[model samples]
Target: MIMCREATKLMSLKLDRPLTRREQLQLRLHTLMCSACRRCESQFELLHGLGDKLPDTDDTSSRS
Candidate 1:
């Protein structure tokens, strides 16, 4: 079983790209047994999605 820290790390990486075979298996195993970590992972995904929707400030001009 993967530890909480390891699982969280892998979950973060998954935000950018699909996890490797080993990482996928580890995360599955870890989440199956750890509810807290799973919740944390879910929250991370939600926050990541919200961030994606935010507009970039650099694209906006301040002239008025």
Candidate 2:
């Protein structure tokens, strides 16, 4: 079983990219026992959807 910190990191990584089969299995097993991670997973899923609607900015763009 993975710890909260590690699970959270994997949760974020999954949002950015496709997790490997091993990673998917590990996270699935962990979440089965951890409601906190399950909540986090749901929250990040919302963020992933919102990201598509947000504007794009780059390093060349100046920050206010």
lDDT of 2 by residue, 1-64 (tens): 7788888999999988999998899899999999989999999999888988898879666866
How much does each candidate deviate from the true structure in C-alpha RMSD?
Answer: 2.5, 2.3
Per-residue lDDT tens digits for candidate 1, residues 1-64, read 7789999999999999999999999999999999999899989999999999998786357655
What shift in Å separates residue 23 of candidate 1 from its native position after superposition?
A: 0.4
How big is the positional error of residue 46 in model 2, measured in Å on the Cα after superposition? 0.3
Q: Which ten residues in a row have the lowest lDDT in candidate 2?
A: 55-64
Q: What count of clashes does model 1 give?
A: 0
lDDT of 2: 0.90
Residue-pair clashes per prediction, in order, are: 0, 0
Q: Candidate 2: TM-score?
A: 0.80
